[model samples]
Target: MRKLIVTEFISVDGIAEVERLPGVTWNDEMQRFKEDELADSGAMLLGRTTYEIFAGSWPKETGDFADRFNALPKYVASTSLKALDWKPAELLKAHCRKRSGN
Candidate 1:
């Protein structure tokens, strides 16, 4: 079976928010960490909201990260999403299930 890794962005106080936290610095260590994580992931599994955010922004972005993100196969698990225009996308109809804490 393929390893299903679910990476998430959360606050220290336990809030699920996708935004740059205040006072958090971006450094080489963080970049290397992210690179390592993504290196192991063959594709991206995203929810509707995250998919919408990435699909809208990553296509216009440029750089190694953007290139990698845009090129990876995206598996969007959603019930209401009817269409996906992004390349290499697969819609997992009604396959989205919430995790324990999500």
Candidate 2:
């Protein structure tokens, strides 16, 4: 079975928003970390908002990270989204539940 790994960033106050916090900025170390994590991942599972955000930006980006991210299969969990325009992307299904007969 394929392993599922989840990565999330949350502030100490429990804010899950993606917006940069006050006095914070993106750094080379963070970029390297993300690159390494993406390199280790075979596929990406994203929620609707994240999927939309990524689809809007990553496709326009160019580089190793963008290349790998665009090439990887993207599975989005969204019931409201009617279609996905990104290449190698599809709506996620409840495969785990189906497999376990839950």
Give me the candidate number with maximum TM-score.
Answer: 1
Cα deviation of 3 in candidate 2 (Å)?
Answer: 1.4
* Per-candidate total of colliding backbone pairs: 0, 0
In the range 1-102, model 1's lDDT, one tens digit per residue, is 789987776767878755664456779988897888888889998878999988888899999887887899999989889999887999998676656865
lDDT of 2: 0.82
lDDT of model 2 at position 66: 86
Please list all clashing residue pairs in model 1, or write none if there are none.
none
Per-residue CA lDDT of candidate 2, range 1-102, in tens?
889988877777877775653346779998889988988899998888999888988899998878988999999887677788887988874432223555
